[model samples]
Target: MSKDINYLIKSSIEIYFKNSQIRDISFNTFLPENRNLKSKRSKLKMEKEGKNNLRFFIESKDITAFRASINEIITFGKIFENVLNLVE
Candidate 1:
């Protein structure tokens, strides 16, 4: 069974991280090809909410990894937000 169904250490979180420039920067900065990421095996689900709005669903079966991944994403988002504020 999948982690979502097994309750065997699963979690998810959503983030905007949508601006085109920010998205490009994040992609380059985060290195999606990295195999060492805690959420490497996790599934990434994304939805386009609007022109520049996106909803990200990060899911993972490894509880520790899941939390760590969320933390990492939050840090990325915080940095993005700070940069966005400066630009705007």
Candidate 2:
């Protein structure tokens, strides 16, 4: 990924974890064993791709769950951008 995109993803994840708390959702910087089995609806995993990039992995049992998980991440990113714009 380009530097800007990587920075955005990194920032979004950091901001989300720092500011929000939701039931059944968790963030792990490192991969976890047997984590998927704990969530029947969905699971989100974030891994470092390199020094500055991140890779997000989402697993869901059905389409609805998958869509909701994706939408939630998108919403977080949008909120982060809005806050950044305000600060700037």
C-alpha displacement of 85 in model 1, angstroms? 2.2
TM-score of each prediction:
0.51, 0.51
Candidate 2 — which pairs collide?
A: none
Best by lDDT: 1
Given candidate 1, what's the lDDT at residue 3?
Answer: 36
Give one digit per residue, the lDDT tens place, for model 1 in 7-79: 4344444444546656556555545632345445465554445444445566765666566666766776777
For residue 30, model 1's alpha carbon misses the true position, in angstroms, by 6.6
Model 2 lDDT, residue 5, Cα: 21
Off by over 4 Å in 1: 1-41
Give the top-scoring candidate (TM-score): 2
CA lDDT, candidate 1, residue 62:
68
lDDT of 1 at 63: 64
lDDT of 2 by residue, 15-79 (tens): 22323332112333123432433455666665544334444667665556667666766665565
